[model samples]
Target: MGCGRPFDEVIAIAPLQRCHVMLSWCYLLLSATMTIECLDLSECQAALGMESGAIAAQDILASSSFDEASVGPQYARIRTDVAGGAWCPSTQIDQTRYEYLQVNLHRVHVITCVETQGRHGGGHGKEYPTFYMLEYWRPGRTEWQRYKGHHQNVLLKANFDTNTAVKITLDTPIVASKVRFVPFSEHLRTTCMRVELYGCEHKEGLLAYSMPSGEFYAGHLFDDRSYDGSRNSSGFLTGGLGQLMDGRTGGEFALGNGIVSDAANAEQWVGWTKPLVEFYFLFDDIRNFTALSLHVMDSSNSIKEAAVSFSLDGRHFSHTLVEYFRYENSSVAPGPDWLSIRIPKQCGRFVLVNIRNTGKLLLISEVRFESGDAYDVEIVTDGPFVGRISSPSFEYVWLITGLLGCCFLCALLVTIIAIRQRQRKVTSPSYTGLKSTPQAEHIAVDLKTGQMKVIRDTELWLPFLNAKANSTNVYMFDSDKCAVSKILEAPANVSSVQPAESASTTPLIPLKSSSSEEDSHCLSRKELFFENMRSEYDNPSLHYAASDVRIVPLSKAER
Candidate 1:
């Protein structure tokens, strides 16, 4: 801060002047290193919507909303307090693990910092998040991953009061298409928050890369532990990218930084033993190539030489450059090297790095693609850059639209069918068809007249009832015998009568009352005899007979 001045002399300066000097000194450091709290923000300061109205309303989402029309996720914006005073959670986060405000960037970008504010009800709101954690998702990621820089899960501090914004610059920025802010607190209270993301577009367009499997050494695995890409049967990383792009570069192994146990060294370096190693990087699309910087542990020149190739497709790569950087060092421990290999006006979607082995051991730490365009957006290697950020496709829109239309038509058809069925049910033939009975014709029935007419005019009804009862065995009483004995009864008079021959005159028989009209409707004498035998013949011995008839044998005419 001083031109090599003594402490006694420095103290002699005025206190106000000293503060001014200190502020200037700090500003210079911030401008020079672009570092704060040991974090390199990369000076990529572009507002990702929230306060700038670029994110849009539909892009914001929440676990819940206090009032969707008023306190919704869209209301969450840094430095402003409108629409129900920031975005308050529907419920207090008391003794809860998660409740979040989410934003979909629609595409991936390097998110270097996040600024936050509480419910600034024009300085009336007390609701603000005390602490929060971030989770993000990007291309090539199957699920959301929580960001932990240097593998340490840390919470970002948030605003304590309303209105005033507090920006939390990440030591390790995040590259994602979507991000979630999960608020937390030690005390029980409702929390509302507004936020903004600061960074630039990830123009490198590097999506994923395939490489040989890492090698093991000296009881330690010199592997990319963070490489989330797929592994093949042959132990190669078939696809995906990890630590190689995360801004946190592997430092001097002898310095003992980013190391695990006593040998964090092995964990950060991507090592291979093959004499000729090949690396394939896939970009989301074609991009112009300017220069590529690589951080490698080549103090011993274990990696002798390398070649660069650019290709429109994965196959038929066109060679760009090859150089031999091999050298022999007699030092006890070989150190790391940084190589900036410039591409001569090349452009392609695929980049191939062919590294030749010199000492049977090769280790690489980091890879960065630099551009000369004004879109010098910082690609925070410390953040997740698993795969290239892909632009949205129009085909997906049409497909979704077609699906929705089909669903709507199906629902309409179902509704129409349901409605018609209901109408049919309400006015069906079962309820309002024929009024006449199918079982019998209607007959005018005056109770007394109907009874007298049935009794006087119809004798078949009684016979039918008797026959039905006999056939159905409906009346056996208690005895288990056939009705034949009851059906036939012997007359009281058994004396035989002389048979009459020739054209026989009608036989005369006495009947009860031939005076009333009922006499004409009554059963004839023969029928009375038969009906009496069938129904009233309960006893065989006791019999009362007014007349008797004897059976005669069938005889031929006059014989």
Candidate 2:
């Protein structure tokens, strides 16, 4: 457990709560403190009770081989074929010298026991050492120490017979990797034997430990009926202790295996080994576990009372987790057997459980330590592209709806205004085409008879005035007194004809040079043209005028 590391280099056990609890140990602090530095021994080849140790035991040394001439068959030889015998010393050598076989485990281990086998003969023939002793060497130690018995005392020699196997069960497991087997008495000069070592692997806590860390140790006893807990020297949660947190309910104590308490005398409830024993658990740092539970069988030996406590540092445990009380009384005839503690919301990494064994061997089928709070784990789906808008919420929906409503309202108002303007244009009156002037006058003239007429109702001529002007003249053809106008030029021989007598009675008006006025009365053009022509064409006068008689005035005829 001595790690050769510097003091300043500290390995973080875990960040407060992330570490997992592998087992509960009574003396973990003591072992942690002894580890001067912990190398990554995960790759280390040696450990307690390793099944592969026999093959890894390569560095073999011996006092003398039976055949010094050839060291191949006389020294350590691994048995490959049953027909061929392994390394054996010469029988002819003197029996006075001490003989020993040594192997290097290549790494440290906490050895609990060892098993040795005699040389097997094909038939009834076999060979074994008469007496032998087991010894081991620590990593940095030059001296060897004899492996002790179950009572923590060294024996001179453990006696054994030939052809029979001898098993040495150690009382206290030792911490070493290299071991030697010395045969004091053998039937032959060289002993033919094989050895096996069993113990826990000396390692860092799989998480944290250093050369200068803390150390602690506690011995545990499991119910002999179910599991061989005593055989587990590593103090790991194996057998019934391992199944304590399996999350099973009812019959927990007697589920796969049962936990039996140590035997105790009557009237003395507490015993050194059992009946009343305390168990300790350590976490990497301060933690608040939810609950602790104990399951007992419905029997006389079921646990009647228990208590719990907590500690931050392994030393001080002042907080009480639970007080003692009888969980299952003897009066109850086979009912549910379970005891639970609320844990009092305490924050600590160390927990102490004190259990009572009721006279008879207590059988606990289950134990539980709920580590954390109940929670739901949700796995969010992440897409490759980010910054995408999330689904619209209720407020977003309302805001969008309000904006759309405002837009629709504005459009409706514009449509109403446009309809009102169109209606005003349709309802109001409009005047178009020609307007009458006081100076302008219209005279209707007849072309055939050279007669001129005048009329009053200006509204009656609205159709003609509103009509678009074109080459074809619009006039009334029937005698309906419809108003119409035409200009007639006089005939070419008008000078040979004479004017009517009424035409002479109408005095001819003189013409102005720049006049656009319609003539009120028309006379023969030849007489007027001859009189007006100061200069003339040779044939006739070029200036021709129309002659028409004007109708009588409306004001003088009808009243």
Candidate 3:
């Protein structure tokens, strides 16, 4: 401690020596603190949990399987579910290019790179793909598109031999739910593969966009050349994401693979001749929007203002927040978003951006958003997915049961009515082959107290007419008295003749008749007083169980 201090003079500078020793301790402590702070785990983060088997077995799939017991799609896990050491197709070889191994990430993710390997059945399996192509699909889409980098190459270099995992980082990150790996070779050989996807959860939440088409000025086509959407008959591009959301800011230069293709190019920007442009964005998931960032480039400086709004459904929108672009600071991150515009505080899945250009031409490069999946407070009646199931509430169950019961009873009543009408039609005199003129009604017979006689008005009818009418009512009388008179016809007003005493002669009635009524007014109100009363026989359409009547003459053998 006294290596550089004088013996006698040390007493005078003792405080300074103690101060210098304390400062040395502080320096060492500071250095140690700085070292601890610099050690962060994010810097050395490599793979996204594939080699460690964090992905589920069910999430991985393949086009075909060589053997289900060993090499099926579920066994396609990176390093864990190696049933036969890897996934191999049913046809292992020499000619086809249709086989592919697929992985469903379950949700949209920001994919940064892809890692692939081959089946390593110890030393026996020496097969591997030299090159492979990637195809990816997102939600709300039907087709799987082949991925192309800035240079527009599809085939990616894989591995020279089995067991060596080849890693390739993408120049343009993919945001999708499913990605498939298609293996390829120049000549012919059996192809099989095991693969892993690397990425983080998607943050942008955008699914698609619909916007007005870019313009064609002079000899140049100032269009969204890299846009993957279709143009409508009205010259609008819709239902696909494109260069505006590709994370590239467009200006006077065109760049491909880090090389300048043109110095005065504006291909990344979608331009229009109109003074205003409308953009509708569809998100992959619901979000709480905070602000928006629009990157606009106009060499003529024609742009004036912009505004934004949001919607829970695509049809309804919130109030548009006006041109507050100049109010907020323009110093934003170079990529994704450039000029920030604060939007209203709301939660939704759709966004509308309106840019008002004060000049004749408009150019827009990119549109990036500021949003989050976690809302401060929200209540959703429906989810991101929908399905149908049997209702659980008994309140609705009772209502449905009541309706069905009413329908069944109504149907039973209708059936009974139809049957009664059909029986009446079959029993009618007209249906039994009897003919009577409109003015000539059928004959009738009546009996009472062992005495029977022809109806007073029907006495003029022919003998056959009496027999036929009697046959229709023969059940009203006994068989002993059913014999017809020897006279071919009956004379009118023949009340002097007496009836046979052997006949029971009780009058038939369809139903019991009440001896009394509560009020004669009830009958008069319904027109049932005396002769006004209606009976089943008065209506030919009515059906009633009736017995046939038979006639007999008064003569005996003694005569």
Candidate 4:
């Protein structure tokens, strides 16, 4: 047989090639289908979007109407009999039902407009009809969420042949798939005619620019003498020293003292801003910047306690101390005329130095940002040190002592007044009777008996003295000559009678009269008188004739 190519072999190559081409076409179609489905539009509509121009849309949901049966599936029907027109019973049945619409979307860029309308069949009685809108969504992989958006005022008006449209802009972007609209009532005929949406992109970052001050240069010039720079030696410059105050400028601060001197004859340049004052020093090139020097002098002298701070960004700062010096007889000491602070590393473009004078005087002479190797220096001073005599002032110790003295004086006065009051109370006449007095003695003598006696202390006395008969007998005698009579009356039943011729010589004793029963049975008038007088005298004494003594029965005397 001839070696002709078999028909099967030729066909086999063609079939194989067709199969390969078909398989390649199928692979491409599959890849394209997947790409279309996997692509995400949500990121473009929200904050994560690749483009920088996207913004969010405001979503509004539902609203309400005062009338019953106004906005659901059970549409309201007007009744002519009622003044305001009542919704019919049939129409009220539909009020509970609702008419809702839902839209599913991948990404929502912006909501364009919302338009609604309501029926106005009732007479002028029902002026306007109101409705509401609702929005729903599913965020990320989460379930459905809903929100309400309604205007304060209702949209539709009664008997008006027009619809109301509301527009809203969102403050933030949202990524959602579905949204919904819901009405408040079912009967007051209300409808949403249309809703519109627009795609959007994100916005880019804000442009950075330098803020300018109205003054010239980066440092302000302040004239110490007059209001203006010409008259006053000092004037204020807002931005560094070179730029004008009105327009924006990028410059560094430079401070120079008109004359260089020691602490005595130094000039000061003061620059003050709001709370955060920033000073930038631009170097020609990067070098070994070590120490920063500032010539600062406090004019008020109140700045000794003031805190000095340094900073890089003008936001954060570090603190240091300002040393004070007094010259003696033109002899100068190594005082800190310029503050030398160490800088750690070289900064880019410019170095910002912030000086916050927490002290009384904010005056500065010159500030120098020097390269440590270059030995650069700056001097700033508030002119010459003018001395002013300060008046004498009271110290805290003196004030405290004066207060204590006043308090002590008040306490002493109080004590004296208290003592005087106590003394007056004791000496007052009202309490005199409550006090005790010394007793006085009194003596009484009996004239007829010539006897004397001593009376014991007495304020008051009782009449009728009774005693048992004893050998040592009681005597009644004359005040002067009753000694013999007392001896005779010492014994009971003893009697003594004077001789008739000697009656005048011896004292006569009076005897009880037998005829007078009153005198014999009771106390005599003299005894009663003595008893009554005893209350008036401190002490009393009585004298009687001893010859008158007689023994008698007690029962007879008592009667």
Model number with the top TM-score: 3
Candidate 1, which ten residues in sequence have the lowest lDDT sum?
476-485
**Ten-residue segment with the worst summed lDDT in candidate 3?**
33-42
TM-score-based ranking: 3, 1, 2, 4
Local lDDT at 244 for model 1: 78
lDDT of 3: 0.55
TM-score of 2: 0.31
TM-score of each: 0.50, 0.31, 0.50, 0.21
Write the number of the candidate with greater lDDT, choosing between 2 and 3.
Answer: 3
- Local lDDT at 14 for model 3: 21
Best by the lDDT measure? 1
Against the true structure, candidate 4 has what lDDT?
0.30
**C-alpha lDDT of all candidate models, in order:** 0.57, 0.40, 0.55, 0.30
List model 3 lDDT by residue over 1-559, tens digit each: 1112221222232222223343354333322311001111133224555566666767777888888778777665555436676778887554355788888877777676888787776666676778888888877655776777645677799888777888897745676788888887777777667777776766577767777778875445667654444566787776666667666577565334545455344556677778778888877555655556666653224445666777655666656543433213433333222455554334566688777676655667777676655432332221121111223346667878999999999999999999999999888665321222233233233222223333334444343243443322212222223322222112121322233354332212222232222212211222111112222244221111111112333222311
Q: Write model 2 residue lDDT over 302-352, tens digit each, in one string.
A: 555566776655456644536555534335355335555554344456577
* Cα-lDDT of candidate 1: 0.57
User: Which RMSD values do the candidates have, in order?
Assistant: 26.5, 25.8, 26.0, 33.7
Per-residue lDDT of candidate 4, residues 1-559 (tens digit): 0012221221222221123353354333332311001112243332221112121211222232234344322222121122223222122112454544344444432222233333333323322224444454432122333332112232222223322323333212222345554444446553322233333321110001111122222333332211111111222221112211111111223234532233222212333433334443322222234344445443223122222233223333323322222223322222224444544323222344444434332444444443321122332222343222222235645877899999999999999999999999888744132222232223333434334343342232112111232322332323333211222222223344222221111222222212333323332333212222222222212122232433222223232
What TM-score does candidate 4 reach?
0.21
Displacement of residue 150 (Cα, Å) in model 2 is: 6.8
